[model samples]
Target: MKVCSVSVDLDPISCYYGIHGLGEPPAPLAHVVLQRALPRFAEIFQRRGIHATFFVVGSDLASDPSGRATLTDLAKSGHELGNHTHHHRYDFARLSAEEIEREVADAHQVIAQAQGSPPIGFRAPGYDMSARVLRVLESQGYQYDSSLFSSWPYYFAKAGVMGVMSLLGRRSHSVLGDPRALTAPVDPYRPGSGPFRRGQSSLVELPIAVSPFLRLPVIGNWLLVAPARVRTRLLESVRSRSFFNLELHGADLLDADQDGIPTQLISKQHDLRIPLKDKQRAFEAMLDRIAQDYRFAPLREVATDVQREGKLRAGGQNL
Candidate 1:
């Protein structure tokens, strides 16, 4: 079984950098990572003989020509390039259908211009999405969306509905009121037949990997917050799962001492103050471990593989 699929969310906005405690606008740390850390990340992956997807923000491509060139280089280096969003907006759940379409379309255009092809995969900022968001993604020609995580692979719909409801504060005894509620598979499962069919839609949903601990999602951010021994146990637990989807941010690998934002946001999630060197060391350690046990693939490749396998199991033509 594949134990992990590594992905990076590259959000380049000053607000994102600030909120994450990387720095204020024109985050110097962010620029450094784009220029320095990303190349190192690519080198690490290449040395390990693995490839991971990079979900880039459209605005980042527009604002930073060098960053765009670097992404194109990554693609040339055999890594997958994907779209995060144009503005990296957090309120996708509140946006209207038309608005969602425009945002996705605009981002698609920018990514295509930079990479010389439209992105085949997308990840909504904050994993915030709605049914309309899915509709637009499918219509806009995205092949996969990695924005939702299901605790259990087999019973993902029910589990994801419960998890999403709790997060959105719309949980009720009688009905699932979360606007993001949909019966799409929570892992790398195929959509239904037809354009609007829940299971047969053209797009595949590849949610982040969550651990089975207390039925909660176990992802990278959570791993960062866990104690050393506990994190070890969680990683062991992840190796036992059917599939492991690990995520990282470009900023996560950068040092705080670098010219950039303040230290509050980086330290916000954890009580202990993690210095830049330590952060880089921790990330390198995680990459080393993943390199040993997993065969990393881009999100689009994974989804396509899953779809083909599912079809084979059902005695249907390969997708």
Candidate 2:
């Protein structure tokens, strides 16, 4: 049977501040996501009877009681809460091995404390992963990593945007990871000794879903606001893959007015500009199509299913 996985990265507003190069605003922005957006997400998933995965940032959990409680509630409701590094650093790929280890371990403890168990899955901050990063995960006995996004179109476009941001004198808090990541597998694999190449390793890699043609990302960050025609074309390309992963961010469900998000922030973020109701409808439409076409499950369960298939890690122990 064809399989699908849906997951979200619950990075708080501070991460966005870094991404936009806003550089620590004088006053903190209320985590619009924690207060409203996440509740909306919980409602949608609960109504749909979907047990999705959520990658949680460590420090974010430490920030507020409400956010922590919300995340704990998600775990209690049967959704998988996975690891996102402690600081949500955009340059995770550039961090030293010791720092990487600290990041993963710190987040693991924080999440485990909130959820009553340590996470088996991880997604790197900013979708950045490298051989060193995987080694850190392996050391911690993580079962899977879903940060490898091998999409040239997405990568190059990001580079271009960052370049323009630099030229315009805005300090984009993001960085372009190794260009080699674009060559990573379009499907899940057991990352061997190499970063992208398949091989024997205790840790598995479930890359972010990308359209095989032109390597466009098939995730909510792009599709939730993409025109129907564009989304339709992208969906067609991804249907051919055996395992499809749809990744979303906590910011996807926030609105400028209802969520009290700054108008300037909304203006700069393309996806956030869409009306919340419209975005919900678009997401539901896509989810309807996905449910019709494939059997869906939480990402950790999906990875377990993949490992059970005996397709990856030849002669390599099942992850």
Candidate 3:
């Protein structure tokens, strides 16, 4: 079965650039995401009959009254709500275990209050995670995390990093310079161990989808920017081996051209300057195509399906 899982990283506007800086107040972009982009995203998913998982930042919920209401509405609309950490911090690898626990716990509280139930899944900001972070997630009662991008669909960790390192050596403007050091893989698999493991940790890992060439993140640059024909071919190529996981940022759906976004990030990914209406049309079309070809499910359902597949492969028995 070709399973499709769509997820939105609900990070705050401050998280868009990097870590928070001193003396920066909340900006209009934050309100734009909460007020305009998110609702439209939800409506698009609903219109296409796609049930997506929204991995929300804990601080976004706690800080914005409207954001809290948006999250509640999404959960009530039958979409899954998951954690994207409180501060959208990228150095989970460096944080103490206690701090990790606090971040996850705080996010859980805010999500539970807003959605009327605690979130059972998580996705680290910038896909930055360490073994210690996983341990904290397990302790916090999270059922799964979509942060691990093992080199399954493509060799993202090895080849992708090599390319970034090469590019960075030439010039300093590479996106690779951003924190988190770009060690994530392109597909989902167990961390540090072989692909299949038993009696291991409780958290399930679901990685973002990427194309085979250069291991570019599938949803954002490749799928969103590519022409319709190219996007279709790319998704079809990856549909056979692994679950097709599409990830997006709330800002990706916003019209950067009309929205008066700061010129810095816009120039970073020039293709993003495409008109907002065009972006939405392309995104909605992609969702429609995926719905026609694959079964859309929440992360929990994907994990369950994988477990069941594993059991079936092992002499038709339950683990």
Between candidates 2 and 3, the TM-score winner = 2
Candidate 3 residue pairs in clash (backbone atoms < 3 Å): 149-185
Task: Please report, in order, the local distance difference test score of every candidate based on alpha carbons.
Answer: 0.64, 0.82, 0.67
True-vs-predicted CA distance for residue 53, candidate 2, Å = 0.4
Which is the leading candidate under TM-score?
A: 2
Cα lDDT of candidate 2 equals: 0.82
Per-residue lDDT, model 3, residue 237, is: 68
- By TM-score rank, best first, the candidates go 2, 3, 1
- Candidate with maximal lDDT: 2
Q: Pick out the ten consecutive residues of candidate 2 with the lowest summed lDDT.
A: 310-319
- Clash number for each model: 12, 0, 1
- lDDT per residue for candidate 3 within 1-319, as digits (tens), equals 4577888887655665442122232477766666667888888888877788988888888888987898788888888888888877766545899988888889899988988988988887655566778788877877677875433323344346447646665222112222232345444444433212323666556667766654555765456777888887877767654467888888777676566667666665455588878888888777777776677887767766554464322122233
Q: Write one digit per residue (lDDT tens) for candidate 2, span 1-319.
A: 6777889898887777777877663354645566677888888888888888989888877776788899899999898999999988988878999999998999999899999888999998888888899888888988888998888988888998899989999998788888778887777788887668889878778888888768888889798767899998888888776678889998898876776677667667888778899988888888888888776678788666556775432222233
